[model samples]
Target: MYGDVDVPAAVQRALTGFLDLQQERLEAIGPELTEQVQAARDATSGGKRLRPAFCYWGFRAAGGDPAQPILTAAASLEMLHVSALVHDDVMDSSDTRRGAPAAHRRFEALQRARSEVSGVGGDPVGFGVGAAILLGDLCLIWADEMLHTSGFDAAALARASKFFDAVRVEVTAGQYLDLVAQASGVSDMDQALRVLRYKSATYTVERPLHIGAALAGGDRRLIEALSAYGLPVGEAFQLRDDLLGVFGDPALTGKPAGDDLREGKRTVLVAYAVDHASEVQLAEFDRLFGRPDLDDDEIQLLREILQDSRAVRACEDLITERTEDALDALDRAPLADDTARKALADLAIAATSRQL
Candidate 1:
């Protein structure tokens, strides 16, 4: 079941410790700025810490010492992820995150309270969004600063920087594709795969692994092998997330059921269902997709339609296929240690098997 890979207890400690270090750095910047940064930092506290863990394990897999520098660099990635989330929540107008008030919402509350006390009308939404945007930018800048100042050798720093740059570029491209597809709809499997590669796979898994490996002085061949394993696994992970967004229990996922349906995410599952659906089903989809006002019963019916159309089965099959591809790549990779390999394998399983 769980704990299939004996992840080093020290590694886990290092991850948290690095996070604390970054928090301290953020707080020290200024007392006036501390509240915003602290809010941003608190937003990240409850995640699975998957990215940092991946970075740590990837470094260890390449025989790098889990020293201060490595731990700091790994934590930096977590900060970057937080930055992305702050911006994403604003973009999505999400009210909650990790089962709590989203950053912008929290700021909105603060603004309203201040306005009521002062008897003035301040644009809460605008102020909240502006603050969130700045906070996200600060996080990105700090992530780079932390990575650069981690005392790695110049060569290692350069390599890691290049890898981070690639990650940023790929993730931006992926996000653009996601937005485009949401607007235009994905017509075929090829376009859907492109979305998967750019939006989720490269940033979520491949680049994180590569950055860790690069920091540890891994050879190009090793990095390439890790990327191969990461791509399909990451895609599978996102696909599972897509399913959960539509079908998962709200208590488990910290989101309302059918949030994805409301959001109109052009996921592979939706695309497959639309392609295979009958005319009536297609009409129902067109009516419900992206409609925020749909009631619970309507959402339930949409789920039923998805099940009836066998899109659920098709998505599950794709998960299986992608998981197998990831494992196959791992089998052929020239990993140096059994622990690292086992951890990667367990991660692949855990990522797709998650209920929330």
Candidate 2:
């Protein structure tokens, strides 16, 4: 459902191989560590593999071959993404992910089960949180290791590493900004967009493209062009995600509806609603928008306010505008491979389409 590049299978194979090897290594150190590795595997499994799709097609666009090294390097993005998701779930105190118990939640359940069987007293919640943090850190470390061992030429790996490192720093900073915005309860679109760009745009698309291009020894011109196309599409992807958080079906999204509202996301959709809401609507918004105990009826009420204020429609327009801009940039990207260009074109639509 992504780039139509037939690479998801290959990416999955590569990821499985790496995880298997890492699990063996972990077992050698201590069998008790198996659960952490299993958690990593669980976090890495499923999802769209969008980051790897972006990286693989980016490499192909820059004339990289469908070789092992490129595929392995592309698969490394999944590791980094897993690290983010595990930590993000912990930070959000989310109970579920990908339609299953979140990492911390899973750990918490395990702790509870052990306590019940052993009749022992312990801090199950704290243990779960601590274990999840270490698991997240392990994923981060392994992601770097995977990239370095991906079999690319040393020179190429070095070049790609720069972008890879930048993505980590930028995403961390973006997460910090998001936390700040939520804490301050700011409703400014500018702050929301800033957080969006740093938290998601670069990591999801721009730097992945850059890393892929660097691995292929692509020149500065190609890297810049890919960035031009990636950034806006990335923004559109996140905007659509914000919409889905409130309006999407749980069956499709693997999340409860209005979870973002309960978390006080401070997304652009909320900002628009705040700006456009009438007195009565604003009063209702203030009452139900961010309450942890927000009920289904209140969610429906907020949805009505968002719709009546045209925030949802305005966000849809922005998504469409950004998608068009991304396609236009793709057309002018100077890619020599027609197939690569077409794949990226398909990806732009997939990235921001309603079905996502």
Candidate 3:
């Protein structure tokens, strides 16, 4: 699926170089800025480079040659992704990320320690939240900066910038929609799906492809085909994630066990379960699901209900259906060669598969 390009390795090198340069600039500000830069470095570490892979392949499929500028620009997508994750962790009040303390949690812990020593900072959690918000904003700005400084000519950058801008808006709107759905405590499939498409579908896959394609000066035909392939794949990707969030090993997922259940994520699976639930099951589900203090037995019981409701099966079907749709579209896309098509097909499978 990777073709000749080791996308993850290449992006890692690019990110390392970029962060090093960023650190130099931060040094001019103050030595105390060391932690901030380290925080950024840590956040960018251990990513699957999925977004960057999509961006790289999109450029490749559009007939773009391997170039240094593209690598830096692709790495910027990771910055954007990291930005989203930091803010998302804050929003979800997640304790861990990538199997370590979440950005906000890290900051909170730092503040708590400092407050204990000096007795200065009040409300350590709030301090952590504020710091994480700044960190997310910093990454967001870095994403734009990295792209603009990627050494691409103005024309190509201009072309790609449109999609980059659009993706930012789409992901933010999607996140807001998700927040609304969770707060409303309504498990409507249509609403959940809307949240899915906007939150994950467009930003994660479709726009990354579009940005890369545009950078390569690909025509509207190529852009449409990429979306035709990318959107369904993106939806399937999130659907798989929904299942994992509920049922997968927390250690593997780098999240608290049943965190999604505790948070009451209004995913399509949840919607399906709710729609098909019996009266007594609904009552129990409402009582136990989303309770922050739900015990192990309650968690197991929720899992059983999800399984018995057949929502898991429905979600699995949707993943298969969307993956097939993506592969079909990729087979028909006007890619530069068969290699790109095969790589894309491979990515589709990886995105929708159960593996983390």
Per-residue lDDT, model 3, residue 233, is 94
Q: Which segments of model 1 are wrong by more than 4 Å?
A: 1-31, 185-188
| lDDT: the better of candidates 1 and 2 | 2
In order, what lDDT does every prediction score? 0.79, 0.88, 0.90
How many angstroms is residue 241 displaced in model 3 relative to the true structure, after the best TM-score fit? 0.5
Runs in model 2 lying further than 4 Å from the true structure: 1-4, 354-356
The residue-by-residue lDDT of candidate 3 on 1-356, one tens digit each, is 26678888888888889989989998999996777789999999886787888898899899988764687899999999999999999999888998899999998898899999997878989989998999999899999999999889999999999999999999999999999999998899999999999899998899999988888889999999999999999999999999998888877888877889998899999999999988989899998877878788899999999999999999999999999999999988999857778888888888889467
Give per-residue lDDT, candidate 2, residue 176. Answer: 90
What are the per-residue Cα lDDT tens digits for candidate 2 across 1-356? 45455667877888889989999999999998999988888888788878888888888888888754787898889999988888998998888888889899999898999999999958889989989999989989988998999998899999999999999999899999989988997689999999889999898989998998888888989999999999999999999999999998888888888999899889999999999999999988987877888989889989999999999999999999998998999989978577888888888878788554
> Which pairs in model 2 have colliding backbones?
none
Residue 267 of candidate 1: its Cα lDDT? 83
Point out the higher-scoring one by lDDT: 2 or 3.
Answer: 3
Cα distance off (Å), candidate 2, residue 313 = 0.7
All candidates: TM-score: 0.91, 0.98, 0.98
Alpha-carbon lDDT of model 3: 0.90
